[model samples]
Each structure stands twice: as structure tokens, then as C-alpha cells.
Target: MSYMNLIKEKDYLKILIAGVINRFGDSIDAIAMTWLVYSVSQNASLTALNFGINFVPTVLIQPFAGAYVEKLNHKKILVFMDLLRGVVVFLIALLTYFQCIEGWMIIVATFLLSTAEAFRMPANNALTPVIVKKENFNEAISLQSSMFRLSELIGTGVAGIIIGLCGVHVAIAIDALSFFFSGSIILMVKAKSYLRIEHQNKIFTDFKKGIKYLFHTKCLMRICLIGTIVNALLVPINSLETVLCIEVYHMGAELLSLMGIFSTIGSIVGAFIYPYLAKRYTERQFIVSFLLTMSLFYFICILNKVFLNLIFLFYIHLIISYFSLGAGAAVLSTYSSVNLLDKVDESFLARVSAVCVSLCTAAVPLCSFLVSFLSTFINVSDVFIVIAILSLLLAVLYSIISKKRWLE
Candidate 1:
């Protein structure tokens, strides 16, 4: 089915709109939050710490959240989480507007936001299959991915303009409003309760079962490991992009926003192309090739003076690298979701998703910390090179593993 038809489904349409609105707000908030923290502290480590805090709560909460989602109403969980986040974010905006916000407050707010996210993510993932038809599932995911990128493109562009004109507080207030609007849209989705009555297991027992299933499923395990490694290494790169643009490139928020726009455009293109590519290549082939190519672009990005105009060259290289990374990410997300959905029972979906997401994100804080520590000792450019090399090694290692059928 076409993307239009997929969105025409009432439940899927609600979910899609809610997701897009939330992501748009999130994209704006991402830039605003990073800029706010960095501007306040003028410390890269603290900035990285702020980014790290967002994921740390998920690492600790997602498994439990997933287990509970199986027993609770997904819609209610989503709505409650959104409302909670909206309140917290708006409070933060008020504090900021009053000049009462502190650096630590941002970190605390991020942690709270992530706490809601820990449950909301798994619930959202589980809700998709229930609403979308089996054959249209992949299309729905791809469309969602495309919309995410499109939202990011628009949100980041608007954020840069807003921050340039009105400052971060206003941008944040907008994000807060987005959350409330997203919750209202989610309330419009009409789906039967996905609560599984047959499973009366304890939460810890369900968590354990999820972990056991993940490890026993070698393909899923391999994918999870690779994802974790990539996420860990990539966190620093993303967490420090503003630093790269402002500190290293001698630019301002406009440049940072431009980079975000270009990256999201690349992601949109990748998401748009995924369905066709999935038909032509095996998941292993698509993932390996994309990773390898993306790593190559990262290497190129490290060459600061490759062209006569260094800054221009950097922009060109960064855009290409982001494009490749976006494509790879889209493919990886689709492959992981489709494969896991087929492999795992529906009752276990939320728990499995939670565990997988947690595992993939577990090292983010530590890695962000590592980057912050390394920055104190090394050039940020040198850190980028190190990430590139590690990524290349990972791609090569995964290629060998695929060849050996270790991922089978």
C-alpha cells in the first residue's frame, strides 16, 4: 500500500500525527536544550553530561517500563507520559523565563523527561503493529521514519530562527505546548486495549524472560550488540555537534542549525528509499554496506584541509556523512523492528522492545562521559577521528560475523 493509504487508517493516522508532532517538538527542544546548557556552563563536559542524562534514566527504567506496559493500557501510558513531560517542560520554561533556571535544573528535567520516554517508547512501538495491517507494517514504519526526519528538518530550522531571535526559553515553551498537543492527538486514536490477560508473571520475571529470549536469539543479540557499540561511539559526536560548529568551525547557531537541517534531509531521503532497498538487498547486506560507506564519510570529515576552503569542505563532508548515517539508521531500524516482530510473540513485544532499547542505550552516558573526559585531553577533531576508526572496525567486524553466519 502507498504511504497515503497507510496514513488513512484511522488509528495509524492518529499515531502518525502524534508521533510527528512530538518529534517536531523534540527536535526543537534538542537544539534548545543543548544550546541552553552549553551557553550556561561554557563547559563541554557539562554539556555532554546534560546529553548523557537524557538516556541514563531509560537505561534504568525501560526494562521495568516494558514489563508493565504489557499489563497496562498503552494509550493511557502514552497520554500520561506526554502530559507529564508537558508539565515538566513547561515548568522548566517558566523557570528559564524568570531567570531562575540553573544548569543542574536542565539535567534534572532531562532525566525526568527520559523517565517518561522509557515507558512511552515501548508502548508506542507495541501499539504500531496493533493498528497497522501486517502487509502495510513496513510501509507504516518507513512513513513514520520519513515524517520524523521531515519534522526534524522543519523543527531544527525553526529552532535556529527562534533561538536567534527570541532565545531558548521561548523555544522551550513551544516544545512544552507541542507535548500537550501531541497528547491530545494520541487521545483520538481508537484501538482496543493491548493488555495481555494471559500473562500474570511478575515484572522481574518478565524482564528476565525478555533478556533470556534476546540472548538465545543470536541474530537479535548480534544486532543489539552492534547497535549498542554504534550508539556509544556516536553519542559523543551528536552531543558535541554544537561545539564542533561554534567552537571549532568559528560559526554560530545558524551553522549548527544548518547542519541539523542537512542531516534530517539526508535522513528523509533514506527513509523514503528504504522500502525499495529492502526489496533489493538482504538486511545483512544493506546494513553492512551502509555502515561501511558511512564510516568512509566520517573518515573524510576528519580531513579538515582537504579542499582550499576548509570550512566549506567540512560542510560538504559533514552533509555526506550525515546522509549515509541517516540511510543506515533507517535501514537498521526497519530491519530490527520487522525481524523482532516476526521472531518474538506479541505478548512479549513491549518487554523485548524495552530490553533491546535499554541495552542499545545503556552505555550512552558512560560514552558521553568518556568523550567529555577525552575532550579535556585531546582535540575534539581527534575524538572525531577515533570515533570514525572505531566505527570502521565495527563495520568490518560485523561483515566478518555476517560471513560466518554468527548473526544467523
Candidate 2:
């Protein structure tokens, strides 16, 4: 029999396309929402709060959501979440276009969107391995990630232009439409979801089991910790990028758009090169070395003083840096599960992935607030230096810890 018969290729392709369409909305919203909040309130704290609200539901609800995703039909759960998000986003788009949207309304929309995402994310992660053959799984995930980056590049670049020409409301409306389109695509996909056993054990028991699995497994736990710290350092730099480009460097949306493009180009390059690198380096060595290199690159980008020249240098640096980052991340994601896929079961997969993503998501808001507040007191360049140093330090610490624990 053909290998194609082993998995639902058509359904997988639909899921990937749906992800791209949905993320176009996500890309626009990332810039538009922050700009909208900052425009209205003219306060850093309020903007930070918007980020905080976006993450709160995922942080609070993810453990339970993980357990819930395992027990349900993953495809149906994905569809329902997308539908809920589409409706919420469409309403926000309407309210925004009418100039009726308020700060609180924006925050509420973020909360709802994140809550839906909290449900959808774990289901999608679990569903992937179910639908794709084990041998092709890495390629599937890499393609998905590269597509996501492409969506980010296109969506954010377009958002910059649209926000400049038509304003934030139009961008928000487009994002809302994108979500609706994504939901429709999800509805078109068909897949066989594995049935979960009726474990009479408590829900917390399932949650704890996932946690215990993570903790007892040295490689997974260390990766999570390293990932969390790396994110903690990285998110603040991103939060400050817009402010740095516009306010400090006297650049505009055009340059910001260029940065997105170059960064994405780097990711595409990285994804393609990853398999080759996998053959050349051990996973741990590759991860730690790349993390350290990216940290240094970020530092150099900030230290370059010439505005236009800095952008050019940053363009090159980001491409290389992101390629490294993507390569490293793929290694970690693959290694997150060491054993045969069948033993961990779907619910366990959901729980572990949820917790990991939740922690990473939670870090962004906290770090954003820290970055914003720090910018008010110190130079943004100084903030970048601090972040770069922290990233380097974390990479070193992670290496030592991994070695001592025999995590490899």
C-alpha cells in the first residue's frame, strides 16, 4: 500500500491552510490591538494590560483544557473554538468600526480570544500526531511553522500599510474576516480522532499525571525551563521593538514591515536547514549554542547606533538569528517526547503541551510590562542589553544544568 494511505494527507493539508488563515488575523491583531490600546489610553500600563489579558485565560484555564481536549473529539473541539473566536472577533470588528469599542471592551475581547485559544491549542497539538504518520511528523510541523511565519510576515506587513492608510478599525475588521475564513476551512477538514478511555480517576489525577511525567523526565523538564527563560528574555525585546523603531530610531511602519519580512526570511531559511543540522549536531549542543548566538546577535543589533544602517544590520542579524532560533526550537519540540508516541496517550500529550505553552504565554505579558516600565526609567537600549545578557546567562545555566542532570 502507498504510504499516503497511512495518513489523511488531504485533511492535514486543510488543517495547515486553516492555521495560516487564522494566523493572518493573529498577525494583524498583534500590531493593531497594541497600537489601538496605546492610541486610546496613551499609557504604557494599559497597553501592557492588554497583553496581560490576552494571556490570562490560557494561564488559568490550560491545565483543565488539556484534560478536556484529551477526552473529546479533537477535530470537533478545534472547529468549535475557531467558530467561537470568529463570532467574538466579528463583534469586536463591528464595535471598533462604529467607534464604540472601549479599552475594557478590547480587554474583554482579548480574554475571550485567549480562552478559545487555550482550548484549541492542545487539541491541535494532539491531533497532529494522530493524523500524520510518525516518519513525516517532523516535516509536517516544520511546514506548519514556516507557513505560520509567512502568515506573520504578510499579515503584519499588510497591517502596517492598512493601519497607516485606513486606520486600525479596518485592520481589525480584516482580522475578524480572516478568523471567519479560518473557521470555515476547519469545518471542511475530516479526521479520525482517537477515543479516550473512561478513566474513573479524578480530573486532577490526569493533570497530575502529565505534570509527573514532565517532572520525572529530565529532558522534557529541562527543555521547558530553558524555553520559559528564553521566552522571558525574548518577549520584552519584541514588546519594545515597535517603540524602539518609531520613537527612538525615528523610523516608521515601513521599516518595521521590513524587519518582519527579514525575520521571516530567516525563519524560512532556518526551517529548510534544520534537517541538515540535525545530522551534524546533538540536539542539546545545537540548542544551547544557537541560543547563545542569538543572544549575542540581539545585543549587537541594539548596540549599532546608526538608525537606517542599524535597520539593515538588524535585518541580516534577525534573519540569521531567527533561522538559528527556529532550528533550535524544532530540535527541542522533537525531543519533548523521547519514547514511542503510542505510550504517552492523547490526554497526556495535551496536558504537557498545554502547560508548556501556557507558561511560555504567561511569560510574555509579565515581561512586556517589565520592558514597558523599564523603558520609562532607563533607555530602551539598556533594556535590550539587559535582556541579551539574561538570555546568554540562561543559556549557560541551562547547559550546566542539563549536563549535571544527565538530561541528554
Candidate 3:
């Protein structure tokens, strides 16, 4: 399907606009949040732990959030979640501006923001199929992914300038306005769903049903488990990114912002090319290709970190390695999401997405803690290399399983 078809679907286009606006705010918040955590707590381990905390509520709440969202109006859920997140961010901005913000306050703010997201994500995922044609799923997903990355690119660039001049509070306050804008725009969308199921059972029972359904599906639980570990291993690379930039290199927020800029550049390239790549490659071929590519880059990141000798080499390695890593990650996420959507029934999408999202979210905090814990016994750099190798081993395991036809 041509991207033009997607454009003509005005409802989906509205949703895309909402997504772009929302993610634009999120990109700004990401920078603010990262620096805020580190600024409040100077310890690298604590900073990583707090960074991971943003996703912790998703793991705990989304399974129930999924089951609950199954019976509700998805559009309203989107609006509510947007509003709720805006309020939380606005409060954070206010506290920061007042010079009354503490480390614990930042943690609470992140927790509340993600709590809204726990409910918001499942509803949005469930709502999408109703807005767009199933035939154009990959194309739409790719376009959405590309736009998201592009918005991040622009948002981070702008955020750096904002944070440098105005302050983190201003950047966060701007993000708050974006949420309000996105929520209002979504109210203009005319999407409705027939998938609001009436459940006789309690939410816990519905949660079990979602899990039971996964157990019955081929490689479903297995896939989520593997994804959890791989995601966990991959997270420390990002979770401790602040430490890497600040302590290791003596560079600060500029380098941190540059990292996001480079990543989004790679993500844009990857997202635009993914639909074509999906058509050209088998599922096994696609998975193996990205996994192997990611492993290669992880190795390169290690060499660049250890063999830090030249300023030119440092920037060169950062650009090339992160760009390639970012591209691999974007392609894998797009393919995996579309593949999961294809396998799931429309009615079960919210719950299943919640479960899948839960595991994926669960990985980050667990491993972020692991990174901190391991830092006590080994050098932080060593912890990174160990996790990178573990992630690579997942690729090897999947390659073997895929060859044996365990997965399509």
C-alpha cells in the first residue's frame, strides 16, 4: 500500500498527528527527565535506578490496565491519559521552578507519569486497528515510527537549546502544553470501536484469560520471555548512558543531547526503509539480521569506550555505532509489533499488548538494578560488556530456534 492511502484515511491521520504531538512532548521530557535524575542524585547507580523507574509501573499495572481497557472506550482513554500525563508533567515543572523539587519528587513524578501510560498504551494500541486498514498495517506502522523518530530528532534538538537557555523547567512546561494539544486534537477524531467487550468475570479473571491465551499460542510466551531478557540486557547500555557521557568522557548535556540526535537520525533511516525490508525478507531472515547487527555494534561500542584515545575517534564511533544500533532497534521493533498485531485477535489486542508490553517494561527496571548491583562487583564498563554478550547470545538462540521452525 502506498503511504498516500494512509494519508487519505483522515481518522488515522488524526491519530498520527496526535501521536506526533505527544511524542514530541515526550522527547523533550526525556532529556529533562534524564538530566533531572542525575542532577538530583549524583551517583551513577542511583541515576540508572531512577531512570529505570519510569517503566516500573508499566510492568506492575499494565496487565490489569490491559484487561480494564478491553471494556472501555479507547478514544476517551487516549484523551484521559494525555490529560493525566500533562498534569503530572506540569506539576514536575512547577516544583522544579520553585526550587522545591527533591530526588524523591522526581521519582514520584516519573512513577505517576508511567502509571497513566500503563493504561494509555493498551488503549491506543487497541484503537489503532479500528482506524487503519489491516492491509496497510506495516506501512502505517513504519510511517508512524518514522514520524515519531523525526519528531524526536527535532524535539531533542530544540530541547537542548531550551534547556541550555531557558532551563529544564521551561522544556518540561512546553511538553505539558503538547499533551494538552494532543488530547484536544484527539477529541476531533471520529473513531469508534465495536470491540468493547462485556465481561462477566472480574478484571483479575480477564487478566488470567489474557495469559491463558498466550500460553495456548505458539511461541507466544516463549517469545515474550526471550524478549524480556534481551530488552533487559539492552537497557543498561541506555540506562547508564548519563554516566558514560559525564563521568567517562567529562562531556555533559551537549553530548547527551547529541546522542539522542544521532539515534533519531538512525531511527528515521531505519523506519523509512522497513516496509521495503519487510517485504524482501523472511521473518527469520529479518530477526537474525537485526540481532546480528546489534551484536556487532555492541562490540564496537565496547572497543570505542576502552580504546578512547582520539577526540575525533570518539565522535566518529558515537555517530556510526549508535546510528547503526538505533536503526537495528527501530526495524526490529516495527517488525515485531506488526507481527504481533497480525497474530492477535482485535478484541484481545489491548490485553495481549499489555502483557507483551508488561514483560518488555519489566525488563528495564530489573536490569537497571542488575547494572547497579553488578557495578559493585565489577567495573561499570565490564557490566556493560557482560550484558552485551548476553544479548548477543539471545540472537544465537533465536537463530537456532528459527532454523528448526519453532517460529514463523
lDDT of every model, 2 decimals: 0.81, 0.70, 0.81
TM-score of decoy 1? 0.94
lDDT value for candidate 2?
Answer: 0.70
Please give, for residues 267-316, the per-residue lDDT of candidate 2 as tens digits.
65555455556567785686677568658756755755553565667566
Which window of 10 residues has the lowest lDDT sum in candidate 2?
334-343
- Rank all candidate structures by their TM-score, best first, as comma-separated numbers: 1, 3, 2
Candidate whose TM-score is highest: 1
Please identify model 3 stretches exceeding 4 Å from their true place.
198-200, 222-226, 305-309
lDDT by residue for model 3 (259-343), tens: 8888888999888898888778776666666667666666676677654678788789888877887787787777767777788
Q: Each candidate's TM vs. the true structure?
A: 0.94, 0.87, 0.93
Pairs of residues at least 3 apart in sequence or in different chains that clash in candidate 1: none
Worst 10-residue lDDT window for candidate 3 reads: 221-230
Error of 3 at 379 (Å): 4.0
Worst 10 residues of 1 by lDDT: 301-310
